[model samples]
Target: MSKQVMLAASAVAVLMSCTVNAATEIQWWHAMGGSLGDKVNEIAEGYNATQDQFVVKPVFKGSYPETMTGAIAAFRAKQQPHIVQVYEVGTATMMSADKAIYPVHQLMNDSKEKFDPTAFLPSVTGYYTANSGEMLSMPFNSSTPVLYYNKSMFEKAGLSDADAPKTWNDLELVATKLLASGAQCGFTTGYQSWVQLENFAARHNVAFASNDNGFGGLDTELLVNNKAFVDHISKLEQWSKTGAFKYGGRASDAASLFYSGECAMYMNSSASYAGIKENMPNTEFGVSELPYWPSVIEQPQNSIIGGASLWVLQGHPKQDYEGVAEFFSYLSSAKVQADWHQFTGYLPITQDAFELTESQNFYQENPGTRIAIEQMTAVTPTKNSKGLRLGNFVQIRDVVDEELEQVWSGKQSAQQALDAVTARSNELLKNFERVNSKS
Candidate 1:
């Protein structure tokens, strides 16, 4: 080979190395595992393929609570990732960390990214929006709870599959039939506090906490001991005694009961659709709106969301913000959003995405996938239905779960358990406020 040709080859190799080194790196720490984790990696790979200027890397960091805690610790050490995924319950904590976050609205405006807040669905975005009407985080996998019933079990019990329980009264009646039909249990639920208490209050148009469920200010207190809650819990306690209702444990543990065909009806997050489909390939199940008590309210109110969002962290360079904003723009496109909604059974964050999914006839082919979207948008959200915002809510939910377990075990009455939960949770809230107020 000629010396000139060798020099040209050396120069080309050097240029290629420089191009690779020039791309900025963005770190994303999240709690997505299993198949969801695969999708997260796929998204990052797709974005990286679209451009050589930036590379977004996704790192799984255990569960939601663990991931948020890790991010907080990292931020204090000045080693924080560029982005983090925080569940809805942690909203109050994140908002209080004013200096630790780069609000999505501000980030987009500063980065000159094309963003329209109105393009997102109001129901999904309302949870992450500030009182000033600015969006705080990018809505990722928003979901709401719904009723999932085994159609085969319903038929065996001589109940019509189309007539899944619409009201609490109907649920009791159906539970009785299901139990009598040789089912191990009538129904079970995951996230007892979320589905049976928090959502129960929203669906009944009753407040779960004072100050508009803590959206107004930090001086909020729990109001879950209200008559609606008391009566509902008391009824569940009675049902438990008769084996009509079974305590399936906490946080999707009861999902096993449904999967094993022990429980005829299961109440869980809409995001569980993918798991259910994958686990029970031959089982015939249908999704329905969460049951409400007609006697409590003439009509049920809209349900709140359950899932997490993508929050941009502070301490990253200005160039990183630009890349993050551009990645977000790509994530929010109709095609991307629609694909995510269809795959994960999470509600599409934007109206355009929902419409795009509809245009593809995804719902027509998969019944019950749209039930959660319909249930969330059925009625305009009032203060009670907007969603909860309480400091230390992750711990507050644990308190609620503990107290509720007491009621299930007959160690405490419904009123006693809820009253205890309120008292304990309020003390945690007070501490959170006292510390954050100073900051």
Candidate 2:
């Protein structure tokens, strides 16, 4: 070959290498596993395909608590990811560690990204915002507890498939019939503490903790031993004896029971919709708002969010942060949010996404798809329903689960179990406040 031709090819190869090296890489560590992890990777791939200047990489870092703890350790070692996904319970911990986080509002402003906080749904952003209304993190995959029932099972039970139980009384009657009709279990639930206690009290407009469920201050104490809470648990204990209500462990175990047709009715996060469809394609199901108690005078209040959000970490390069900002902007688009909501059974985080879905008649085509959105937006969120901001909440939930199991085992009454839970959880609350207040 001629020397001139060789020189031209060498220059072209060097330019290609520079172009590939110039693209910034932004790492995002999250706790999503299995199919949800695939969705996270798909989102990142879409963003990478859309832009040449930045590439977002997603890494699963175990469960939610472990992921948050890992990020903390990484931060101390000066090896943190550009962003980390923290669950709702970790909101207080993240808010307190202001030094380790670069708040979302400031990140967007500093990077000159187009971020309009008002575009997001009020209930979603409220949980991760400052007292001054500044957004702390980007809201993603926000979900609320809802009722899911097998329509075919309902038909066999001689119940109306189109009608869902609006109150606990109705649920009891239906559960009795469902079990008597050869179903293995009448009803079961995931997230026992979340569905039975936290959201239950919120829907009744009752406080789960002092200081507006810990949003007002860090010195909040749990109020799960109150009459309303105890009475609810006591009723569940009674139902357990009659085979009407079944405790299927914590977190998505009941989902398996329901999807396998072992249980006729199930209560779980709205996000479970995707899994139910993917895992049980043959089973027809209906989704509805969570049941309330008809006797309660102030019933039907809003339910709290249950999923996680994206938090920006400190010490990343300006270029990496700009990539993070750009990726966030892409994720926040209405089209992306709508597709995500439809595909994952999670509530859309923005008003535009919700409206876009509505405009496309997606809900009409897919029956029961709108129930979660309707349930969440049924009423403006009260102080009790805004969402819990408790510290060390993952451990507190474990304590609650243990005490609740005692009630089911008949070792203790509902009131007795709840009393123990409140006492134990308060100790954790006190310790958290003591340490965090000083920090």
Number of the top-ranking candidate, with TM-score as the measure: 1
Per-residue alpha-carbon lDDT of candidate 1 for residues 53-119, written as tens digits (9 for 90 to 100):
8889899999998999999999999999999999999999998899999999999999999999999
Backbone clashes, each candidate: 0, 0
Q: Where does model 2 exceed 4 Å of error?
A: 1-21
Q: Specify the poorest-scoring 10-residue window by lDDT in model 1.
A: 13-22
Per-residue lDDT tens digits of candidate 2, residues 92-140? 8998887889999999999999999999888888888876789999988
Query: How far out, in Å, is residue 352 in model 2?
Result: 0.8
TM-score of 2: 0.93
Residue 439 local lDDT, model 2: 73
